[model samples]
Target: MGSTSPPATAKCSSDWFAHKKKNGRISRCPIWGDIGEKQNAVDFEHSFLRAMRASNIEKKDFILEFQLYLTHGSPANDWYIAAAAAASDWDAFAAAFWVKFPAPKVQVRMPMEYEWILTELRLDEAKLLEHHPDTNNYMWKCNEQANWKDFTNTIKAVKKQEIEEGVEHQKLLEKTKAEVAAVQKGLWECIPPMPETPSKALGHSLAGMGFADNSRGRYGRDQRGGYAGRGNYRGRGGGPGQRNSTPLTSEKVATLAWNVALLPHHPNTSEGLQAYWEQLAAWAGRWGREAVINHEKPVLLKPGMSPVASGECFNCGMRGHQGQFCEAMGDQTLGFREREWRVLCGHNLPHSSGHSAQVNNVLDDDFDTWLSGGLGKGEGSTD
Candidate 1:
């Protein structure tokens, strides 16, 4: 991980700030590509030394080889060549090289639009937590291309330009800050249970229709359905807070349980909605339990899924089941077997025998002859 040191007398390549060319074509350095104002002399030195060491070249040979790549016509270039010639050791040469060619600082031009500031420059907590590659790349590019001082100045210039262009970067900053705060709050706070949902209301109403709650004081009544908390089945006490004297039929209870189980707009949060559903199920007893079982595990349909022959019937608007399994048909509940009859026979016949066609007769020799006019009737008979 530590940077490899080269001989102090070694000179960096002439094309270090500029990309090198091979066969008259620009060539990318094996480590860094497209060197621009972003790269400085020190970066070239480190990269060149690492590459030379990796190639197993000796210090003396590396110094001689590096001297060959020094750019001409510059006073710094002249100093580098002279330093390499007069150097006593690798350390002395390297020290001279850096003193003569310290990395020059550069500034990057900012884009006209301010939106990229939020997207490219501003830190995003979500992206940071996710360890996004884009975020890493942006940070690396800023550091490698421009120093912190130059980058900060560029950001200031960008802000001024944005205000002059009426881009509202400040408003965007405020909005982003608010969203971050809200997300943090949601993460730290304990989630509260949702208010009474429609399903809960329906479940309560069903319980009131005479479903006895052995665990609680009589469900809809204050421990009594009549006067003086007792004996009479119906009386002045049989109002909103009073228990109903008439018990719900099994059919009514089953229907109500289904309705409660299928109620939409349950809370979007998983824990809250689950608690609400469990409470509703407990109140309705066995029927509610069945509803919960049938509704919870829904068939997931998505694009590119394998083609299926038949599934739960969507026509019936049920979940965890598909349209093909639907039982509805003009005031009658039809099972899969019953539905198959309509598909294969075109109608619901009283019996399979109602077809009125005899397969045995149709297969008889006489019937075949009658239909074919005795053509080729007998193999031995030419007629």
Candidate 2:
């Protein structure tokens, strides 16, 4: 008779089982117990079954093989052995081994909602969402780990800090307001009229006063274009002096002086106007003594009355000058000292917006001559 053939599934030889057998247990068999990875257990099961089939091990012997491979130290290992012993067929045994080890259950954790976090924190959802954190982890911690206790504690701490800052700021503001009130008390009558309305007009009034405190421009120029000093006025050009110079006649000087003196007499004069005249008086006290004396003379231009002795620049109405000449004729930078005199003295002179004094027409010839000879394309033009 021919030798019996091995089963088609039999791949392992008796020699392989001989190597696996050591003493009583299968020594070289893979252990299934304590497998951390589910895939590892599955892979071991596949290979172990294939080896058993190839070796042509009987069903009863398969249990012994499982006992050797699925050894101690695992709950699943114990269950797998019992499953293998009770299994009636190969398919049942295979199912038992696999049931003990399945792919680790996939754990899905949902992210916390941003709106829920904002609600828990008692923050404005609209505002907080608009801001961003430096890292996703930090933001996650804020959203996930922050509890009601933490939220309440943070709110209390922030409120305390804000209150302290507000108190300090209010104290400073009150002190400033008090000091301002004191300063304003003395100038109550002098302060220009405050607007009747308390909204935009009040803001403008406060701002205007602030401007006056900071610089000369606020008080220096009036709505009517009156300036207290020499620099700003482009004087009515042309006279007996430099044709470019706005020289005042005897009549114009008298008129201007009266207007200035009567400004303080007006019904509702502004503080700036009052202050301007006060400042001018102070200046005159220091420099106008001799000019005052010369002014008393009946004829300012008459011979033998030294213009220098008069103590004022009659050409510009500034102190310390002779009537024969004025610095204003060529220099535009002479400050508005002469203008103060002109405004105070008053005149029917044309407004700044209107045409220049008609006197310029008559002085055209004199102006041309002076421009050709005196003011060359030279020194003063550079400015």
Candidate 3:
């Protein structure tokens, strides 16, 4: 039975040292501890009462011997009096001991006071509940208050919605200026006017007699009764025997009766032949220049004419020979003298004293071979 004492093993090693001396040390174990030793002993008694009232040591016996040397562990000369009381009472020792310590069941935490929960919430809900331990429902206390006229009625409702959008943009600019003055008074009552007549109102009152009073002038009623050139005084060329004899047929009525008889044969006119028979009866009653002065022919020329001969070139105006014999005037040369017809026996020779002596001896031997050589060798020879 004495051998049974082996079971004691030194009384199970003194009951495992009395259950680790009532479960305390091995670094205060919670499974191999270091679990922020009671939040570092409440941050060493809130940094030893914030370094003994910032060294002014408002002696409550030097802040109870500096909270008994930071609750007995902050040692190194109590961190040199909690670093000289956090350099002179750093804000009343960070508001009485780092915001009145106490909370610390610790899983590692210390930065306290969190600016009193960012002065009670709203800094974007206190930066989204700081690192949330449900941020003590954003704990506050540093004076609280607000509502300045609900922020001045939200800035007077955004300046009364920007002054009612500037009075609806000035009533849409006065209804776009009354619809553009009623579309310019309905386009000035749709246009119209241009009609006239009584010989186009007496050719716009004898357009100072040179006629351009529109419809290129030739005043009133002439199909064959009277007024046109006055020849009928009603009888035997007086008023009714009616005969200024119409007849003229047209080279634009002899060039509008030679431009209305050169506007009254202006040699300072003393009624130049009665203003050339009233501008040759108003250019033979409207531009048929009395049929090219009764068919004697040749008139066309008017586009800045000057001396343009070779068939009078209105740049080929009358459609035939002009632009200098126009093979579109490519090589230039058109001089023009050739109108010869002197037949004699076959009869056509007329144009004033028959000529063509073999075309005037071939134009006098081409003007004596172009005055001896200045040009004739194959004519103005460019080669």
Give lDDT tens digits, candidate 1, residues 261-282. 3533334366554654454433
Candidate 3: residue 70 Cα off by (Å):
94
| Candidate 2 lDDT by residue in tens digits, 1-383 | 54344444532445434544522223344554555644466567666777666656776666656655654665656776568668887677777666766645666554657666666878654554442422321233234224556655665666777889989999999888678656645554465653676454433322212111122213333444333322222232111111233546768656544443343322224654455445444444344434432222221121211122112233343332222223343232223444333332222222221211122122212544565565546735633
TM-score of 1: 0.20
For residue 73, model 2's alpha carbon misses the true position, in angstroms, by 3.8
Candidate 3 TM-score to native? 0.12
TM-score for all models, in order of appearance: 0.20, 0.20, 0.12
**In model 2, which regions exceed 4 Å deviation?**
1-29, 35-39, 103-383
Task: Tell me the lDDT of model 3 at 150.
Answer: 48
Is 1 or 3 the stronger prediction by lDDT? 1
In model 1, state the lDDT of residue 72.
Answer: 48
Ranking by lDDT: 2, 1, 3
Best by lDDT: 2
lDDT of 3 at 319: 23
